[model samples]
Target: MPAFTIVTTSATQDSDAAEVNTLTDDFGSETEALGYSRRMADEMLGLAAQLSLDFDYSNVALYDGDLLEEDLDPDHPALIGVWVLDEEGCSYVPAAEFRESLAEPEA
Candidate 1:
């Protein structure tokens, strides 16, 4: 069984409702999972910015066009984080802080 799970969610804004998509990946360690989360978060942020969506972590959305854009809530589905699976159950690390935990201390 995998030791960790990485979950990513994407949403396309619509007139009255939004289309949400979710994907999950399994990894063997927290380090590996966090590395993936950081990269994925960067890519999503880039995409949002390329579409001129502000990427304010509370007002950005990605669409299916060549590069669609819209305003999203703070709980935007741009990038997700890793979930640790243990004997008890699972724990989530929000996307906003996933990379922080993995960062190297500065001198």
Candidate 2:
């Protein structure tokens, strides 16, 4: 059976240096995986906002939905979508569209 892997990347700050962690989990379907990813990204940013802390970034990527393996790469061609902590709030960007966005400059 095919499964989806959700990859989460979170940034942390401290007096010494910034820290980052990548986590992954598998889900039975794309819909279920995306839903869980969005909720996780939202909760991470929401807590940072509530505490008035410096929030660098947190994002979740959906990858390898057609594979049953857990070793999927976040930057692999199989990436299905991404959820980012946007300025307005947590926003979901489809992988295809996100690639285009990365090519553009910020205003």
Candidate 3:
């Protein structure tokens, strides 16, 4: 098993930063992986729009567990990592605070 750090970048600060949720087996190829990730991100942006939420991708980083070898089986690879949606004007809220907010419905 090998660990790989996946970081999603945005050309502008207004883009959404989504963690790669599901990586396919064909991701072994660079082109395939990039395309897959891009599509996933696009879908996420679309969802955000539907929810009337603002998404920003100023920076996104993931630290995979300690593992070496780069080219491994994509189907049975290590951590796929998680994506936390970062919204503008809401960065001050910590994870705990965000959870608390979720407990109450918006008025």
Candidate 4:
């Protein structure tokens, strides 16, 4: 089960969970995966527009889905997909970054 780095552009610095559009599906090839991810970006941008979101630069650019396999470990327990709060907004980090952010309980 491969994972993807989904990106979304937004105007407001704050966007709730509902405003974030996520996708979880495997495709035939890597190209297709990226294509689908970009399409999802379009959907998200449209959504932002409907919500009347405004960006500071009047330019919002979301990232296209990219297969991140550089430092990903499927066996890691903390590699779950979840968004974390940032200065810009809530966004998903890479698998390794997510693991580093976790606070493990004392042994």
Candidate 5:
């Protein structure tokens, strides 16, 4: 069972959202997280849409907190992927790509 972390913070609070967004629950796996997140999908979508957050292609993200911890450095190439919110509704973005986007300047 893979450990999953839920990034829970109202999008309105950007600073608060960035700091320690992970939930206390340690989900067993992506499948498990998916199941639980699906139940709260509406709420998640509301938050994401409100903030226009890129965190998850979807609103609720089952972030692999363990994997993210293992690759804390943005420069690392072995980082795993996570969900992000996009126009398509939801999708997964590799860690490296996500970090790079974060590092880049917004037009």
Candidate 6:
């Protein structure tokens, strides 16, 4: 099974907070991540529309095990790798790309 790290950012009372979480449950390829990201983005978009919140893709990120070191730089501008998996009795999609692609339009 491929390992992945999930980076999440949340708005706080004073500022923003970022954290990284690692997962080895499934996922074994980039393709899986891409598909998963798309689906998640779609769902989040729908939720935002219903709640009238500014929903964007920057809220999520996925990292590959190779990139998920104990001392990963938080300011890096590259994607951390993620593994994709294909199991006979399970299905999952990674969502790293969706977060990376969330950019506001230029004024």
Top model number, TM-score:
2
Candidate 3 residues 8-88, lDDT tens each? 433334454433332224234434444444455555556666777665542222323333334322222343432334552
Clashes of each: 0, 0, 1, 0, 6, 11
lDDT per residue (tens digit) for residues 42-103 in model 6: 55445545765542222344555545554543334444532221111112223354334334
In order of TM-score, best first, we have 2, 6, 5, 1, 4, 3
- Which runs of model 6 end up more than 4 angstroms from their true locations? 10-24, 66-78, 81-107
**Per-residue lDDT over 9-88 for candidate 5, one digit per residue giving the tens place of the 0 to 100 score:** 33333243443354535676667776665555556666667876544223344455555444243354433554554454
In candidate 3, the residue pairs with backbone N, CA or C atoms under 3 Å apart (3 or more residues apart, or in different chains) clash, namely: 15-57
Best by lDDT: 2
- State TM-scores per candidate: 0.40, 0.69, 0.35, 0.37, 0.45, 0.46
Q: Give the worst 10-residue stretch by lDDT in candidate 1.
A: 58-67
True-structure RMSD for candidate 1: 14.1
Model 4 lDDT, residue 93, Cα: 48
lDDT of 5 at 88: 48
RMSD of each: 14.1, 3.7, 11.7, 9.7, 5.7, 9.2
Sorted by lDDT (best first), the order is 2, 5, 6, 4, 1, 3
Angstrom error of the Cα, residue 44, model 2: value is 0.8
Error of 1 at 36 (Å): 0.4
lDDT of 6 at 55: 24
lDDT, residue 33, model 6: 58
lDDT of 3: 0.40
